[model samples]
Every structure is written in C-alpha cells, then in structure tokens.
Target: MDEVSPFAEVLGQAIYQFTLIKPLLPTYGHLLVSALFPIYIGAHASLSKPSSAAKSPKKSQEDGYESDTEEDESLGDTHKMESLAPSDALMFPLTAGLTLGGLYLVIKYMGADLLNKILGYYFSQMGMLFAIAFLKDCFAVIRSFFFPRKYSGSGRIWKPKPAERVFQGARDDGSSSESLEVRHSPLPGILGAIPLPHTVRAALWTCREVAYWRARLRIHVHRLLHAECWLSVLDLLSVAVALPAIGYFTFVTKPWWLTNFLGFSFCYGTLQFMSPSTFITGSLILGSLFVYDIYFVYFTPLMVTVAKTLDVPIKLLFPRPAGPGEAPDTISLAMLGLGDIIIPGMMVGLALRFDLYLYYKRKGMHKAQAQGNGSDIVKPVYQSAMGGWGERFWTRSVTPSEPELEPPYHDARSFPKPYFTASIVGYVLGMLATLVVMQIFDHPQPALLYLVPGVLLSLWGTALVRKEVHEMWEFSDAEEEDEDSSVTDAETKEPVEAGKQVSLFSRIFSAPKEGSERPPKSDEANDESVDGKSDKKESPEKLELFTISLYHPRKRETSKLKAPTERGQSPEDDENWALVGTAERDAEPPAKRLRRSPRQH
Candidate 1:
C-alpha cells in the first residue's frame, strides 16, 4: 500500500467509476427505444421547403427585405465576400476542444464552486436558445398557413400580373410595370373540377364561395378597423400569456411532458423549415456527428455530466415502470438526445418522399409511352385520384403544373422502398446495439456511433444487393437536367410570352424566381455594366423579362434550391443553393403529393 504508484491509483479510480455504471445502464435500458419514437415519427413526416425557400424573392419582401437600404446591401455584400473563402471543416471540433480545455484548466486551478458558475451560465444560455426556438416554431406555423406549399414551390401569397392594357394603350411609364395579384380564395380549383353530381357540385361551390366572401368581408372589415393595430395588440397579448405559462411550466409546476413537447415542437418545426437537400450531404453530416458523439461520450465526462445536470428538454426521456414488488412510481428513465433521432429520421423522410416521386414517375412513364412523345412532352398533366373506390371516382386529383415527364428510355431503376426499409430497420438495430454495448460494458456509450453505421450499412448494403449503388449514388440525373433546362429556357424567354396566367395553386407550387429581388440582367446589360456604360433606362423587354422572372415558373423544371438572386450580388449564393438544392431534388416530381397519413404526423 505504501509503495502504490500514481498510475495504479488512477487506474483504481477509473475502475471504481466504471463499476458504478452497471446498475445505471440496466435501470435506463427499457427506455432506449420509446424515448426516440416521437422524434423518429415527426422527422419522417416533416415536409418542409428547402431553407433557401425562405430566401425566395417574394419571401424576402414579406420578411421586410424590400425596404433594405443601399447600406444594408453593402453590408450583405461584405458578409458574402467574407464567407466565400474556404473555411476549416473541423471548426466545430476546434471550438469545442478549446472551450473544454479552458474549462478543465479553470476547474483544476480554481475549484468546483467556480465550475458550477460556468455551468449555470451555460445552461441559462441554452434555455434562452430553447425559448427562441419555441418562438420560431410558432412563427413557422403562421408562415406555413400564410404560404402553403412554399417548400414545394406551391402556394405563394403573391402572384405576378402582366401589364394591363389601359386607355389609349399607353401607360404612364414608357416601360411596362408589373403588379402583384393576391390570391384571396383559399379553396382549390380542383374542387370545381370534381366529377360529382351537379347538385353536390353546386352545394360545394356555394359553400366555397360563401367561405371565400366571408373571408374577404372579414379582411375588408379588419382593414377598415386597422388590422395592423389589432395584430400588434394580439402579439402583445400573446407575449403576456406566453411568459407566465413558460415560467409556470419551467419553474413552478415543472411538468416533464410540457417541457418535452415544447422541445419536440422546436426540433420538429426547425427541421421542417430547414431540410437536408441530398442523401449524401445528410450522410456526411450524420457521419461527422457520429464521430463527435462517440468521442464526447466515451472519451470524456463532459457529455454525461452536462446532460444530467442541465435538466432541460434537449433530450427526450421516457420513464420505465418498476419491476414486481418495487415502488409503483419509481422513475427509471431512458433518455435520447434530439439529434440522434432527427438526423437519421430526415434521411428516412427523404427516401419516403423519393418513393412517392418514383411512384408518380412510373405512372407518368406509362402515360408518356401511351402519348408517344416522351422526349418533347413539355407538359404532361396526369389526374388519377387515390382512395376508396367511390371517392376516387367522385373526386378529381390536382396535378402539379410544371416538370414535364421524362422518357422511359432514360428512366433509371429506382428502388425507393429498400432505402426506407433499410434505414428504419438499421435504426432499430442500431438502438438495440447501443443498449447491448451499454449492458455489456456497464457504461454509457454514444448512440450515434451505432446509429450512423447501422443507417449507412442498410442504405449502401441495400443498394449493393439491388445492384443500384451507382444509380442511387447518381440518383435523379434526368430530373436534374430537366430542372437545368427549365432555368435556362426561363432566362432566355420573352416576358410577353410568360403572360398566360396559371391558376393560384399552380403558381404557388410552380417555380417563380429562385433568389433575388431583381430579375437576371440581359447579356447586353451585363456587357454594358462591365464596360461602365450600363443604361439607367430599362428596355420594355427587360421590364417584361423581370415580370416573367418574378411571376412565371420555369417550364419543365422541378422545385430546386437555386432559382435567381434578388440583386444577384451574394458570392455565397450559388454554393448555398447547391447545398439546399440537394434536399429539394426529391420533392419535384410533377404529380399530386400523396396525402400524408394522419398517424405519421
């Protein structure tokens, strides 16, 4: 005992700490899968536009970017330029390492009491972030209602109108000016097209018209009474109610489900607002996190300690029931971080959406074959209702307006079911594997280490088995080319040619402008600008082009992340679009999206 070395003492302490984990692992084992279920369900069902959709030119104006001064543009440009240089991929690792290193030094030199202060500050900051997330979720719901199907390039609040021929056919301005048309009616045109009995159709039409007029009346009355004032009042009232409720739940009552629900809402809404654009990008991000989680949980004490002491809803917890003869309400909880579920679940959702797209493409392929003009088919609107036999016959399906069908010859073999099947199975297996390791070692392990490998293995292994590795890796080439063609054709089109007004629903989901406040400048203007001789006076064609760019959806193009820029100045514009476009690639098949099962959400 007197001759015991320092190394032996440290080893003894490590063994002692590890020995204590045996009871803890068994206690939490029952909670592993159930705790993760909600996130799994929510993320899989989360249908969101690409994050870039938020930057849509119309959205920019809606979000108050229309009033942005020249100073703001200058600032944005500077920020954009700064972001253009390639940065370190390991930035997160470096920042985390430094912060933790500094904390360690402080704890070792100063004392545990000082460490408590730092942790308290950290948790406080985290709570504020959570609160902000809650607010964002609330606002997201509002935006979704106002801008339905924004992510899928459908349902914009504003539609562009071509110049109306006025008196003498001469407008005040020499160049034509476009006006925005607001869609006041909430009902679909497909409702009118429904193949119901005349009496039934009349009743439905009456109901819709009555509803629309009622809304119009309400809007008019609200405007007469200053709607903005009332809205501000409502906002204040909401804040007043929210603060007390938040405080009561967070501190006074401290209900687990309440906090957890809020946290889940935040995660769900945020993920829905900003989604992964591609399978590969999703995989890469998940892979990095897998490594991060393993290192933090296994190699260091930080993750566990922070998780336990933080006492926040960042992780979901499920309380397991007591065994026979034990206390009835003993709280043995199983816990999982939000990230573990969300990251993998996103891939599942994308695969599922891809399955729907492929299903339509398969149908469109048959239709294209029958029509006998697959390659040059500019617009193929397929209307086949899905549901109960009578209902299918009675109701008309709403067809997506853009993205013309691809030919059968170029159609790649798509096995969407396998991707989804493998991902879900791998997730469950990975969860079980994580528990098994914990049970064996009697220690905490990172769930993602198993989860990431499980998902990757399942996805890639299924691809390999189906001999679709290359196809899946290079999925949607035809779709991508079509989208590209649409964008190119759109840029080259005469504005007057774009005057045909699409229905409201079509305009919403149709590709309007990509990004930017102003339309793309013509090559002549571009040359002039380069030579310092750009004209202040815009040609009618340019005006017409701008109007077309603003209002018209690109022909045969699917919804993509990159459209056009507002001012066409941001350097990061293209790279950012590329990153987000990958997420939206799967959502663009020109067919009615299958109505999601209520149970899934």
Candidate 2:
C-alpha cells in the first residue's frame, strides 16, 4: 500500500472531526443565520429607499413646514428619532458595567429563583408584543413572495391603452374613459390551421378566462396585503398565526425551538431598529463590550452563573449527547449568549451601509464627470428574469414603476460589498476559532472576545487597503440639524460702521466706566441712524449673519473686511489707517467712546 502524505492525513483528521461535530451544526447554523438576517434585511431596506437613510440639513429645513403637514397624512414614520452618538458610545460601557454588577449582586443575595420568575413574567409580556410584530412582518414577506407589490394593479383585465387609459373609476363628467385590450396568443390560428375540433376551441376559451381571472385575483390579493390600515386582512392573518404561538409559549411549553425562535426575533428587531450612527461609534461600542465580555466570563462567575440560572430566552441552547454514566434520556446543553451575536452584528450592519454610501457616492461622481464632459450618458433599463408559467401567471409582465426609475446600483444584490463580505468572513472564522478553543479547553468562551477583534480588524484592514479610512471616519447617520433651529452663517459685504464696532466691543468688554455715562446722541446722529434703517429696508437682498464672539480683539475681523474704495487711498495706506483707527479706538476709554453714539463716529 502507498504511504499516506501529511496533507492527506490532515484532511482525513479534519473530516473525522467535522463528522463528530455534525450534531452541533444546528446550533451554529441558528446563530449565524440569526446574526446575519437583520443586517441583510436592514441594509436592503435602506438601499431600496435611500431617501429615508439620510437627508441633508438644507433640504430638511427648506421642506420643514411641508413635511409637518405631510407627516400627519403619512402612514408611518420610518426615520429614527435618536441615533447612537459618540457620547452615548462612551457611556455605554459604564452603564452596562453597572447593570451587570447590580444583576450579579441581586442574583447572589435575592436568589436566582425569584429574579428569574419576575424577569420571565416581564419578558413574556414584552416578547408577546415583539412576536406579534415579527409575525406581521413575516406575513408581509410571505405575501410579497406570492403576490409581489410590483405586479399589483396591473392585471390583464385592467390593461390600459397607450393614448387614453382609464382605471376602474370613471371621471365626474361620466364619460367612458377607455376599453381594455385583451391580448391572445396565436394558438387559435395554429389550431384552425391544424383543423382542430370546436370543443378544443371552447377549452382554449376557458383557459383564457382562467388566466384573466388569476391575474385579477393576484392584483386584488396584492392590494389587500399592502393596504395601509391597522386591521387589514394581512394583520388579521398575522394575529391569527401569532395567537396560538403566543399561547403555546406562555402556557403550554417553552420548548427549545420556541425559545430559539423568540431569541432570533428579538435579535432581528433590535438590529433592525437600532444602529450605531457611525463606524467610530460602532467601534467604541464593540471595544467597550469586548472588555465587558472578558471581565464577566473569565474573571468572575457572574456571567456563567447568571446565564445558566436564567430560564429566559436570552441565550441560545443546543442539546449535546448524554455523557458517560448519565441517564440515557438525559440531555446536556451548550449555550451562546445573544449579546455575542448582536454586538458585533451592529458593526457588520454599519459596514453594509458604508458600502452603500461608497457605491452611491461613486455613482454621483461618475454622473457629474459625464455631465461635465458633455457625454450622453445612457440610463440603464432594469428587467426581471423570466420565471415559469406559474410565476408569470401571478406577476404582471409590466415593469414595476420603482425599478424602472432605479439606477443599476440600486439593488443590494449587485452592490460591491467588500467591507461587508470581509466582516462576515471574519465573523465565521472567529466563531469557528471560538468553538475550536472551547472544545480543546472544555470551557465556555466569551464569543465577543473573538468576534469583536475579528469584525473590527477585518473592517479597518479592508478600509486601509482600499484607502477609504477617511471616508469611513467621516460617514455618519445622524441628522445634522432639525428644521426648528436651522441657521447658517452668511458672509456680508456691508462694512462695519464705527459705532457698531464700538457697541460690539462694549458688549465684549465690561460696561462703560462708572461715572461717564451721561452723554446723549445729537440730532445729526439720530438722522443718520434713521437713514441707515431706511437703507436696510430698501435693500433688495437681506442676509442674516450669525456671529460668534471671539476674544482676539477684532484683529482677524479687520483683516477680513474690504477697505472702502471711496477713500481714494492705496491699499497699504488704507490698511495702515484702519490699524491706526482701531488702535486709537482701543486706547480711547470706554467712557469717551460712549459719550458719542456710533452714528456720530
């Protein structure tokens, strides 16, 4: 027999180990799928409707009043009210530490039994609400899969003519708008040529009617599912499906499958709704939690004890085979905490968004360049791939309005997701490393210890390689400003009157001297003040200037202002005169300056 090579021996050993680990695959599979679902779904949703992700402060301010009215009529608010700021990221570790310590102390003193009961009751109620929401979302997804919204309201029976097309309703004037054009295949001509019987013709007519009705039914179902109401058919169906699951989980039995289901739902909801607004915030959060995980897992017994004692769905559990001398029916379990999945999952989600930002930014730059060069840029046409007869029967042949207007990069599937891909690969490797170490040591491992480094290193390394570190650093999801307090600085061409300058200085410095506040303005100064007010009102353009108080004594301000051309002095002479004037004003006592109004100066 030929001797086995070292590589062959290694490969054989790996296969043997994998076969031994086959039973644990479900546990890891659940963890991986649950962790990735939210990121994938959230990124797709944001990319599909890019407008909802971020809005310019200028646009928001300009449309603020209109948006207020629109909001009242809108079905739902999709924009996040609060995002994770950098300050929040800084404080998160402290807050988490306090909570963990408190929980540990409570469990140590008050007993885990009582604490678990109270927590279980609370979580059950909360989980019911979340599960109902999850069910509704699931129903929507399933409904869309069968009767897509893209094909809604486009049935063959309601087909419209090119020139004059009318939907179901007629105009108030009561004129018949148009007639539907029924498109039939050439099968009838082929049948006639073949000299088919009349019964066959009747059967063909029946099939045509069936096809038309199927299209009508599909359109109706799509409309029903997508209706914007609290108690639509879809909601009713979701409630119907959710009620039994809720009852079983609450009353019947909280089986491992049910526990895992609820845990996955909770993870999905959290990642979908909440996000660290920027990569820096995500990194800070992960870094803090990395230390938190290490402390809780290895240094103290709090984490392991709490995880094992708590009967809630906070951690995912997988059953292992009974050990030697144990009861044959007994089950030993392996557990992984939800935090391990969610904490690093946030970074992965942010990476996907960062990818999207880069994609759109590049697209905009290319479009601008093309426009600059006066090139005729062709818009891409999006077409859905053809499917079987059943799929074509349900979905309309007409292209959806949204896709028609969407650019080529609008679809999430086609996006160049180097950062997202890298993070996902890193996560898998880290998780496998964690499992390997756990197996070797015969101890539980804090998954985040490996996960955090894997995610962060992969993301930052990809950024360094791509030379996009600056772009990632600057990317933010927070709204820059709200409409109510929006104000921007404007540069003004108007010269600062000497009186205005003195008044500004007075405000900056202490009040005028104690005994010299008796001087009043003359009639000429009053006339000049009235004339200046008239000139301001008569000017066509009114610019609002936002000022910041600087302690530099107007040195920079003087340098920035243009000298008066009417003075007929050289630039150097004007500069010297301005400096002299400013110095004299500064040297002159505030009392002296206050004796004359700014108009007099």
Residue-level error in angstroms, candidate 1, position 364: 2.8
Error of 1 at 108 (Å): 9.2
Question: Cα lDDT of all candidates, in order?
Answer: 0.44, 0.54
TM-score of 2: 0.58
| Candidate 1, poorest ten consecutive residues by summed lDDT | 77-86
TM-score of each: 0.45, 0.58
Model 2 segments more than 4 A misplaced:
1-23, 42-81, 151-231, 373-414, 480-601
Q: Lowest summed-lDDT stretch of 10 residues in model 2? A: 214-223
As for candidate 2, its clashing pairs are 499-598
Q: lDDT tens digits, residues 1-601, model 1?
A: 5888999999997787567555555545545544455445444334222111111122122111112122122211111000100112244345555675666666557755656655544543455544544453344334333322211112222221111111011121223323422322222233322456656645543543222121100111111221110122223434565566566655565455655655565455444433344556556656766777888888888777656544555677655555447887786566677767766766665555445444555555555676786653223332211111222232233333443343211111222355777778888899888877775676878898998898878888887897867756654211121354677656665353332323223434557566524554443454354434433453433221110001111112222334556756332322211111112223322211111111100
